[model samples]
Structure formats: structure tokens, C-alpha cells
Target: MKRLIRRMTHLRHSDDQISARVRAVLVESLYASPRSLIIGALTSSAIAAVVAAASGDEWLIGCAVLIGLVGAVRIVDALRMRGSATVRQQERGYRIGALTYAGLLGVFGLLTLTRTDSGVLDLLSVTTAIGYAAGIAGRNAGRPLIALSQLCFASLPLVFGLLLPLDPLKALLAAVILLFVLAMSDITQQTYAVILRATTASEEMAALAEHHAGMARRDDLTGMANRTAFREHFEERLRNLTASGEHLALLWLDLDRFKEVNDFFGHLAGNALLVAVARRLEQVLGDRGIVARLGGDEFAILCGVADARAAGCIGSAMLEAVRQPVGFNGHDLRTTASIGIAIAPDNGRDADTLLKNADLALYRAKEKGRGRFFFYEPLMDEKIERRRQIALAMDGALERNEFELVYQPIFDLAKGRITSCETLLRWNSPQFGSISPAEFIPIAEDNTLIVMIGDWVLRQACRTAAHWPADVTIAVNLSPVQLRAPDLTHAVLAALSASGLPPERLTLEVTESVLLDDVDRSLAALSALNRIHVCTTLDDFGTGYSSLSYLTQFPFQTLKIDRSFVIDLEHNPASVAIVQTIVDLAAKLGMRTVAEGVETPAQLDQLRRTRCDAVQGFLLARPMSAPEVIGLFAEQAAFRSNPGQPALPGAD
Candidate 1:
């Protein structure tokens, strides 16, 4: 009998285990369906009502009410959930879900207090179970699986109640199954929400990283590759070309006199000019090359060309690109560029070496007169090395005071007397010996040493003029580079003040080329000097595009005829006629004219006949030391005293 009891106990334990497993599966399946949850609740309530009505118990009515209320609350929740899902805004959906869940739970709690008959309560319980099962199943399967599961579960209690005696065990078992199903549903929902959040966070992180990397690679101002990215890309291309036996070229481009643009028009206009230049380069190069701004007025291009000729073609295209004028700040601004090209495998195999060679070529291109390009060559490299040595030696030369000034007399045609002396620059390099102005002036201009050289010239000229007669003016040729320096006007004003010389006694000679580069700025500088009573002269006139329009546009106190015309005065009638016309024009404009390079008496005679206001040439005196000039004046005084009068011809 004991052995039989043990077997029976073991069988009952196995059945309990199987029932728990079935409950778990049902809970999980129903949790995934929305409609199943509402159906399960309704079935549970109906079963509770039927049980309460058949039993005819007063306490059973309370259970009936509780079951009905749970069903009604879940039904309302399912409807609200559907409504929330239809909303477009995510926040609004979440807010409605939270409010609906809370309200449903409150209604379920309130319904637990009312009483009803046992049969009715039992029917209500069945209805509630069905509604809950249907809601959950619909939510999981997107169908009505919950209603089927609840109907199946509701029949368990009804079948047990009708087949056996009434017991608390059946009621306890029903409550336990309901709680188990609810727990399973909550777990499924929480797990799905976690997965969704993880996916969203990952996508957001990827987008943010991509955005930052893009920003890092692009130039902030010009929207091109920045220097760092350019370097990397250049290196990669170099490697590819080396492997493929293909050739590439690097071009270094620099805008001539860009600083003057910044100084005159402000940074806003300067930025506009840079952006305009970038667009032009892109349009010109197209797919032939990649262009990058190497910071402030300097740009570079990398071209994948097969030969030097192809590279030359690219350079020519770039040159033509910048030839068009750019309008900025309501003014048409004209700019020119000097380009230098270095071929890979010919110039250098590496980035640094290639860039260095390209820069050397750029120096040569600028020296050859800007708005042109030069290819890298062995001879060009040699010349660059020589200049580098000279530049190094110049620093020491300045310290040792190797620089000297020479004065050339400016003779008045009307008075026939020396009225002014123009200061000429002379550099004596101890290592190189007497470097010519034509050679080193350009080097200075390129390296920006002209600012320092110009300052020295201005100070020396002012000091010399202060010692001379107050009426005699001193003319100093201001280089285009020096004029573009940020503090140029201030430097001139300070030099005049420091030397105790009057502004009226100082004459600044500017070339036609200076005026063409940023005419607005050039005019502004000239106007400022004029306001200070400084005499402004257009030097080297009739040489470059003699636009008389500039005369009306710019204020000038004097016009110096270039030496080219003066040198041909005796041979070329056209030269004579041109000089005559210039003098006539000056007279009409009420401007003074100076004839330069008057080496012969014939040229001087011609200039005098033309009513030239001044003449500066070897005929009067070569540029000499200040003391030598004073000595010459004394010699001339002595010669005048002895003149049995083979006297110098007075203004004819």
C-alpha cells in the first residue's frame, strides 16, 4: 500500500511540473499579442459571472464585479494603446501609454469591492480571463490568439467546478496562473524596449562620428581640404604614382600683392577674394588636378599629368583663370598670380622635396615678372641656392652696416639749378661684391626684406634732406612691395617726423604697376600722402599701359618720364614726340614733368625745349655720396666765379 502511495505521489508531482511548463508557454505566447490581452480579460470576467450566478452566493458578486472591472479596464487600455500608436510624435505616444496604463490599473482596483452571486461571479471571472488573454495574444501575434488561450483556460475552472466538490484549491490555482501570465508579458515588453533603444543609440553614434571626421578634413574658410588632409592625400598619391610609373606635378601659386588687399579692404573683402580665387581654380582645373589653399594668399595644385607638357597646359589654364577681374566691396579688383611647377620623379620623389623645389621655381617665376609660370630645372635650383646663400649673408650685412645710399641731383629746367637729390640704394655684399639693384631688389621684394630696406632708405633720405636747403625736395622710389606693408603709411609719417623734415620736401615715386595692383588701395595710399602735403610722382611713366585715365583718378604732383624714352631722345622721333605729348598733357593737368636718363647734352637740350620741369641723369651728376654732392656744389660755385662766361645755357 505504501509503495502504491509513493507512485501516486510521484505522478502528481510530475503533473504539477507539466502544468507549470504549460503555464509558462501560454504566458509567453499571449504576452506577444495585443488583441489576446483584451480577450483573456473578457473571458475571465464571463467565467467569474457564470460561477457566481450558479452558486447564488452574495460574496461571489464582489468577485463578479472585480472580474468585470478588470475586463472593462483592459478593453479601455487596448483602445488607448491603439490610439497612441497612431500618433506621429514619439513623446505623445509614450505620454499617452503611461497615462492609460495608470488609469486602467486604478479602475481594476476599484472594481474589487462590489458583491455578486457565485454563478454570476464565476461567469464574470471567465469573461475577464478571456479579455486579458485576447488583448495579450493580439499584441504578440498582431491577431486574436489571446482570446483563444483565455477561452481554453476559462473552461478549466468551469469543468473542475462542475465535476468535483467545491474547494479553495481550484480558486488558488486560477489566481496563480493569471499572475504567472502577467509576469511573462511584462518581461517580453521590457526586453523588446531594451533592444530598440540599443539599435537607436548605435545609429546615432555612427552619424555623429561621421560628421566630426568630415569637419576635420575640410578647410573652415574655403571648404577645401585643409593642410593636414592635403598632406595625407598627397603622400598617398605619390605612393600610387611610384608604383604605376605615372608622373605628377605640384604647382605653388601665390597672389601678387595680396597683403595690400587685406590692408585696404579689411578682412571681409580679403575673405571674399580668397573664396573667389578658390572657385576659379576649381573651375579651371576641373578633373585635371586638386587644388588646396595653403593658407593666406598661398595655394597649391596637384596634377596627374603624364608629361611636362600636360603640366604646362594645366599651369596655363590656371594663369588664364585668374586673369578675369573680381569684384569686391563694390569695386572691381584685379589680381595676378605667379605659379611654380615641379614634376614628380624629376624634381623630387617626396612631398617635402617636391614642395621645396616648387617654391624655388615660384621665386624664379615672380622674378621673371609675375602673371607667369616656370618649371623646375637644375639651373633654377642652382640659382635658388645662390639666392639662399645671399639671403643668409644679408642678415649679417645689415648688422655690419654694409648698406649705403647715393644721391643723384634733380635739376630744374626753368631754374637750371639742382633743386633736389633722389636717393638710390646700393648694397655691397662682402661675399658677393656689389649686388645690383635689379638683382637684389626683386629678391628683397619677394622675401619681404623690402620693408626693412625701404625703411632704411626713407630715414637716410629724410636725414640728408633735413641738412639741405628746405626748398629742395628729396625723391625716394617706394617699391610696390614696401607700399603694400600694413604699416607703410605710418612708417612714412614717422620717418618724416623723426628726421624733422617737412612733408612737402619728401617725394615718393610709385610705378605704373603698383597702381594696377589693387588700384583702390594704391589710390588711398596716394591720397593719404597728398593730404599730408607729401609730393607724389608717377615714376617710369609712358612705359606700362600709359592710361591717362589714372591721372584723373589718382592725385599726382609730378610725372617722371621713364628712362626708355629719354635714352632714345636723339635717335627716335617717336620717343621725342611721346615725351612732348607727355609734357603737353602734364601742362594741361597742371602737373610737373621730370625727364629721367638724360645722359647727353642733346637729350638735355631736347628736354629743356619740351618745357620739362626737372631732369635727372648722368649729364647732371651720377648718384654720389652726400659729402660728394656738397663738394660738387662747391666746385660748381668755383667754376661760376671763373666763367669768362662760357656760362651754362640758361633755360633756352
Candidate 2:
């Protein structure tokens, strides 16, 4: 019994709390309009006046005066509540006035119905009281307590007065009045529930709309602002800075070798790393700036800075923050970022130009090598224009016959003969005159023109080599972009078939970069070439990570040591050792080794001591035209027949 009492008490308290919430929602409706309040006041005044005049009773006259006062007060309260700001205080006042007025009406009804026997007075008293009770259902329905209170206060006394008569007709009228009050109670409750539901649903819809808007501006993975939000924020900052005469900095950042992480590890790990990096950046910036994840492996920051130097300080801090290794899945995942900064009114005032300039600076930073920052400069625009010009010229250069190939002979150190000639492309544009391959080749690759240009080089080299001795093979360099082409093997076969050059007489060289990304695809392409009996060399060996793994991964016929090591072979004992080690490694693997950029006799002597299979540089011969190569071939043939002449000297 005690537990049941305790539970009932708890339930009653819970119900009280719910009733309080419902009352709060509906309370304003009680004061929504003054028409009902005004009507109640006038009706009370008229009834009191009529009852007092008809009966001429002193006590009833006093009651009439009280009714006038209460009616006037309630009317004034309702009128004053029109534009009131304090809802709680005003609602309390309204409730007090309402109950007071209703109670006075009930007192007057009982006085007129009991003391006065005049038929007209009794009829007016009963009708006025019942009419006021019925009006409470509509007027005070928002607060069911007030509605029900008004119903009882205004009509219960009249019911009592009617029952006091002890007549069947009067008893029936009293019971009908009681039934009317009960019906009004039901109507008031139903109305309150409908209003509450409508208000709650409206509030819920508004909240849902706000949440969706927030999601649209945020990145789903990192919870950082997305590109759309970033641009909007950037424009807002720009506008504010324009007014305040302050400088705003926009920094663009890109993760270096991020794709490798996705390739080596899985994308889930990559996403986690990105999230970790974002948290670090936010912590480093604190409230000093806004960092947004623009897109995959890219982010943008907006901050107020004094100048380029200040921006550089922030960029340095970001670099240090990002350099810290992120721990993921029990391993330390390390990465670095390159930053590009563009300051407002200094780089550009508009958002588009500033963002573009910042991205351009980012490209420059990555180009100079990652893990650094670059400020936007006007010169970058000129360089971009130059690239655009080259891209345009390259589109028609092949058709204009502006491109040609030159062959550089690879001298066999032991055989004392030219074993192979590597094909190099040259472009003498009518517009720009003799652009170096280093400058234009990358631009060509960026624009995807390298594939077309590479195909032409392959065919031309094969045709040129078909005229040379069968022992003299033709070598052509393949860019990573060209290797990624879907029909690379077909292009190679077409070149060989069209030129009538044997597949064994052709060698395709690729750098370790090709094997770095998408290694499976790269290996497949090289394997296809290998299957056709065309030779493949891992060019610029020892310059990339896991060089030995690549050697084991593919059957490369030759390994060309990067010029970086061979260039120092004359004086650096380390370089000699490295070259000797590579030669020994290649010999054990049954692959020939070629040393590039061998210029001096000392370098040559060191390589010879190292037993390098082949050497190609200015020490033996520079690259020459096809005619010069044919002439050199004739001279070599004559020397072979003579058998007593020294080998050809190095060319300038």
C-alpha cells in the first residue's frame, strides 16, 4: 500500500509537469483578442443594472457597484495586454482578473435568484450566468483550468439557487445546466490538445530544416566546413576586410603522396588519417582562423594577417602541425603538406582571382618540392600563359612537321662500340624556336599530348633504326602518362610493324615513378612489352623508393643509373662505390647497366674500373642528327674493317 501511494504521488507530479507545459503553450490564446472580455464586461454591467432597478434592493445595489468595478478592471487589463512584452506576468494578471470577474457574476446570480422573487429579475439572473459559463469554452479554452473554473464559478450558484426551490421544473433546469457545463469541459480539452499538437509539429519542422541547412555546409567525414561554406565564408571575410582596411589571407593546402596512402593502405585508413589531420589543423588554428576541407586531400584556411610574412608564419605552423605522424591502426602514418597563400588586396581583391592565385601558388610549391609554402606572384601568371601557349602549339606541331628525333649513342665500355642509340625529341617551334625537352615535355604530359608525341617518336625511331646495323638497337623513353595509355602495347606493335623493325631491336625505358603509382597496371603494361620480346629498362634507377623491389617485380633488361650519382663519380668515392655496387647487383641479376652523364676521363676511368657495361654522355658523343649518326656509323664500320684505328674521340 505504501509503494502504491508513492507511485501514485510520482505519477501525479509527472502529470502536473505535463499540464504546466500545455498551459504555457496555450496561455497566449486567452489574451489573443479583447472582444470576448469586452462583451463579458458589458453583459455583467447590464445584468447588474437591470436586477438592481427591478428589485430596488440596497444590498443588490451594492452588488451592482461591485460588478461595475470588476467589469471595468478586467476590460482595462485585457486592453493593456495587447503589446505587452512580459507574457508570464501578464498571464498571471489575466488569470486573476478572469477568476475574480467570474466569481462576482456567480455571487450576483445567487443573490438575484434567491432574494428577488420578480420573474423578470430571476430570468435575467439565470440567463446571464449560464451564457457566461458557455462562453468560457471558446474564450479560455487554451487554459483548461481557467475554462473549467469559470464554468463552475459562473453557473454552479445558479444551479444551487434553482435546486433550493425543491420543484420538479426547477430541478430539471438545474440538472440541464450541470450537463451543459460538463459538455463545455470536453470541448475545452479537445481544443487545447489540437493547438498543442499543431504548435509542437511546427516547432519540430523548423528544427529539422535548420539541421539540414547545417549539414549542407559541413563535410560528412571530417565535420569541417565544405567547399561551398568555405567560399561563402571567404567572400564574407573579403567584404569585411574591404570595409576595415585589413588584410585577409587565404591558404590552400594539399597533402603530398596522399594517393599512395590510399593505394598502400585502404581508403578507410586514408579517411581516418584525413580526419586526424583536420583535428590537428583545427587545434593549431584554434579560433585564429577557419579551416575547411575543400575536397579529397585538399583544404583551405581563412585568417586575418598583416602581410605575407605573417601568413608565412601561419603556414609554417600548419606545416609543423601536419608533419607530426598520425597514429592509425597501431602504425604511425606520416605525411606532409604544401601550402599556397594569397593575401587580400595584395594578391587580388576578388574571391575568384584570389582562390585561383592561391591554387597556382600551391602548384608552384609542389613543383619546387613538397613540404613548403609559396606566396602568389604575378610571375606565376606569365608562366601559366607560357604553358598555355606551348599546349596550343603542341596541338598542331606534329602536323606542322616541327618535331624531330635525335639519337645519342650508348658506348660499350668493354666492346668499344656503339651498342644502342637512345631517341630524344626536339621541337623547333616557328613561334618559340628550339624549346628544351625538359621544359616542354612535362607540359605535353599535362595536356595529354605526350601520348601522341610519344607514338610519333616511337615510329620515327623504329624507322631510323631499321636502316642501322641489326646489332644497334633503338631506345625510346616512356613517360608515366604514356605508359598509362590504354593502347600502349598496341602503339608499340604498330610502330614495329610499320617500320619493319624487329621487336628485339627496340627498348622502352621508364623511370621508377611509373612503378610508384598503380604498380599493377604499370607492371602489366611492361609485361606485355616483355612478352613481345621488346626490351624494357628501369631508367633513373636508385632515385626512387624500393628500387630493388621494382627490379624483382619486373624483368628489366637494363638499369640506367640516374645522372645524380654518376655526375660525382670523378671525385666522390661514395659515388664510385654506389656505381660499383649497382653494377655488381645488375650483373648478378643478369641485366646490363648503363651509366649516364659520364663527362670526364676520370669518371670514365672509374666506370671502366667498376666494369660498367655501357656509358652515355658528352665523354663519348653528344646527341646528333640522323645524318650525323649514319656518318658516325660509316666511320665505325671503316674502323672495324681497318682494325688498327683508335675509337672515335668525344664530341663537343
Candidate 3:
């Protein structure tokens, strides 16, 4: 008896385990079979309806099956068009489903009224209507429309049955109940659809915002962060590095002679060169640090390095990267960059200070002759401060008319008389005394103050020369920066018109370096000046490349021999040969030659023998104020009037 009992207990346990496994399999199948939902609902409802009709006593079963069939069809249609429904179509579907549900509930209520007692039908109708009302309220995720729809649907069934009972109140109540059920089902589906649409819109908006932000930070030309973004990122990194005891280096790079390229070629070619330069920089430094376009041929890099040497290596790499030729607009162009390196904790702790220090270092590198890098030093900061003070003082000096011009006489060798005077700029700063032209000219050129200063010199020279004999011409040196100004031609015309000096009496001396900078533009400017009949002289000839070529290409009236050759002519045979060759070449070109810095009589004699057209030095007369020059000439004229004069020894 005990064994039989134990066997029965084991069988029972086995049965329970099998039942649990079957239920798990059924649940998994149902979830995975999405199409089976509509299929199963329709099939079940059809089978139930057919069975009820054949039995003839199951009207309630038929009605329930019909309701299930209609619900299944609507859900399946919604699923079928889920990926293809237009917004308007989707809204229309919601309305159709709502009205269908209402019709179905009304039909079910009518069936109940025909079979059950009046009281029973009324109660069933009210209960079904309440369920429909709740479903509508829950639809649209608790939107006010859902609650209003529910309230209207719920009240309709009771009110219709009470007011308009043509045959029986129960029948009307049943119809109203059926309508309420369908409305609730429609509300539920519409609410789910609305939630999905809203979610999609939010996600799309977020993505668009992210895209715009990315564009805002990036430079369009180089695809690198722009100056504004660079500053923000640089500051953040600096703060982090400061806390971590790490060092950072900032390199400010400026392309040497980039403007020459732009002037020679068109701006399109210039833009192409810039793009190619950006690519080279990216290839060289992108892996190690951050690079940014600080605008107009200037690029900045932020590097994390252990020491200054490593930072230097990176800078050297960058220089080499840009040295390669970039082909643009059918021309192979070459360029080089001057870099300034400023180390954190050594140069400064913040972005502005570091950037300023790097820029100063860059200036030093350029002054040392480009294609090199310099680390910021204490002395550099001192020089920068001094320049700033000088620039400020220069600004005030212009307003106070502290700048003055001194005339150095250019004597005609054949006539042995002063034929013209070259105007030399002199700055007597109240704060710092005498500032060298070599020092201040470059500063002025860079800051664009040269334009103002150049204009002042032109007006002053013309005004002062007007006081001298009309036969004596006045020569003014023009800085290359001033020549390249867009309004340069206009400015010259205005100065001539205002000063009342004949263009024929004015001589403009330009360096060969200016021609090399932009041969075409320089020629154009020279041609314009020549059209006005101004004498154009090639200043400091033989010192720059392509001098002889420039002499033939442009319409120059004179060649001023550089003082270097003149100073060593007495000592160096080669120097004398070079001077003689230049003089001969000038004669061949039909341009007069002037020898500057003639000190001794022997030097003057040698220059005369070379057949140089003119000479200027302390040996003849030093640079003097306008009045001093007029006084010297007056004294010489008086000496000539006295007989014996020896004819003033060739002073005609």
C-alpha cells in the first residue's frame, strides 16, 4: 500500500512539471507571432459565429464573435499601413475605428434587449457604456479630448434610451452600449500612435541641434576649429593641465610672404594655397595636438609636450610640412612658415598672455629672417613693451607734428652742383629720444601706420622742396607697405594736387625688394607714377635678386648704388669692379646712376671716373633741414658771384 501511494505521488509531480513547460512554450510563441494575433482573433470569431448560428440558440455568442472580428480587422489594417500611412490618413483611421466601435456596442446592446429582461439589458448597457467611456478617457495618454469623448459617449447611451424609446428602452440602451465599446478601442489605438509620432519628432530635433552646433565651432575653409572655438577649448584644456601638473605649448605660425602670392596671383589662387596649407598642417600635427585657423594665413597649434625640445620638434615638423610645393591654378608655388612657441608656466598661465607671447616670438623669428621658430624669452617681452610704447608715442607725435624731414643733397658729378635732395625720415620721440628708422619703420609697416606716416612725409617733402629753387628736384623713399595700399594711387594724386609741386620735380625711390615682392603690381604702380612724369629710381640696386631684369622691365629713370659697395670701393678691387659694372649697366639702360655715402675725395674721384651721373654723401653735404640747405646754397651762390671763383670748380 505504501509503494503504490509513493508511485502515485511521483506521477503527480511529473504531470505538474509538464504543464509548466507547456505554458512557457505557449507564451513565447504568442509573443513571437505578430501576424498570428489578427489571424487567430478573426479565425476564432468566425468559428464561434458559425457554431452559434448552426445551433440556433447562441445569439449572444454570435454577437461577441462579430465584435471580435471587427476589432481584429481594424487592428490588422492599422498594422498593415503602419509604415505607409500619411499623417492625414492616420487621423482618418482613428475616426473610422471610433465610429465602428460605437456601432458594434450599439448592436450588442440591441441583442441583449431582445433576449434578456428589460432591467437586465439596461444594466448591461450601462456597464458596457461605462467601460467604453473609461477607454476613451485613457486614450491619447490622458489628453482633454479623450476625457471629453469618453464623457459624451458615456452619457449618450443613458440619455438616448431615456428620451427616444420607439419600441423598448432596453433595445436603445443596448445599441448605445455597443457604440461606446468601439469608441474606446479607437481611442486606445490613436493614443499609442500620437505618442510614437511625438517621440520621433523630439529625436529629430535633438539631432538637428547637434549638427548646427558642430558647424558653429568649425572653420569653413580648413575644417578646423575657428578662433572662437579654439579659445574655449584652449582655456578648458589649460585649466585641466594646470591641475594635473602637465605642460602645454602654444605655437603661433604666420606664412612668410603669403601676401606676395595673393598679389601676384588672384584671390582664387590664394584661397587654394590656403586650403593646401591647411591640409599639410593637419597631416603633420593633427595626431599630436590641436590646430586652428586664427584667420588669414595664420594658424595656431596647441601641443602637450614634456619639454620645450619636444615642442620645438613639432614646430620643425610643421615648417617642413609647409615647405613642400603646393600646385595651384597651374602654378607650383612654395611657401614657408615662421613659428613662435610659448610654453605654459614659462610664458604665461592664460590664453591671452600665451598668445601674445607667441606672437612676439613669431615677430622675432621673422626679424631673424623667416623659416625658423623661436621660444618666448624675457627679453622679447621687454622689446614688445618698448615697441608698444613707441607706437603709442608715434600716434601722439603725428598729431603734435613732431616728425621732421631732413634733405640729403644729391650732387650732379658733371655739373658739380646740387641737382636734387633725398628726403630722409627722422623721428624725435619726446619719451624715448631718437628712434632708429630700422626699428620703427617695420613696426609702422606692420601696424598700417606707415600709410599715415608716408602721407605726412610726402606733403612735408613737397612743401619744403617748394621753398628751394624750382630747378632742384626732391626724392622721397616709399616703403613697400605703403605702395601696396589699395588707395595708394589716389593718395599720391591727392598729395600732388594739395602740395602744388609739379610731378616732374618729385622723384620716388623704391627698393628692388619691392619689385621682387610683386613684379606685376609693382610695374603697374611704377607705370602710373611715370604717367605723371615723376622720376622713378631703383634704390639700393645690385643688393637684391633680379635687379638687372627689373631695370629692363620697368621704366626707371635712375639707379642708386647701395652704400655697401661705395664704402669698400677704395679697399676692395671686386667692390670697385661691381660699382663700375653697375654704372656701365645704368648708362646702357639710359638711366642715370647715383653713388651714395661718398666720404673721401678719392672715393668721389673714383665715382667720377666710373662716369656715375650723381653722388650724395657728407663729402658733398650732410642731410640738413630745408632752411639750412637753402642757406648753404645761398652761400655757394654768393661765392660764385665773386670773380676768380675758379668757376667754382665745375659748379655750373
Against the hidden true structure, what lDDT does model 2 obtain?
Answer: 0.84
Model 3 CA lDDT for position 391: 75
Candidate maximizing lDDT: 2
- How many clashes does each candidate structure show, in the order listed? 106, 0, 8
Question: lDDT by residue for model 1 over 454-571, one digit each (tens)?
Answer: 8989998998889886668899999987766667779989999999999989999999988876676688888888988898999988777746978999899899999999999899
Q: In candidate 1, where is summed lDDT lowest over 10 consecutive residues? A: 142-151
**TM-score to native of every candidate shown:** 0.63, 0.64, 0.65
Q: Candidate 1 vs candidate 2: which has greater TM-score?
A: 2
**lDDT of the candidates, in the order given:** 0.71, 0.84, 0.73
**Could you arrange the candidates by lDDT from highest to lowest?**
2, 3, 1
lDDT of 3 by residue, 14-45 (tens): 42443332323322222233454355345434
The candidate with the higher TM-score, 1 or 3, is 3
Would you give me the overall lDDT of model 1? 0.71
List ranges where model 3 is wrong by over 4 Å: 1-215, 220-223, 240-247, 256-276, 304-336, 345-349, 392-402, 484-494, 546-554, 569-578, 600-611, 643-652
Runs of candidate 1 exceeding 4 Å displacement: 1-220, 242-245, 283-289, 320-334, 388-400, 482-489, 605-611, 636-652
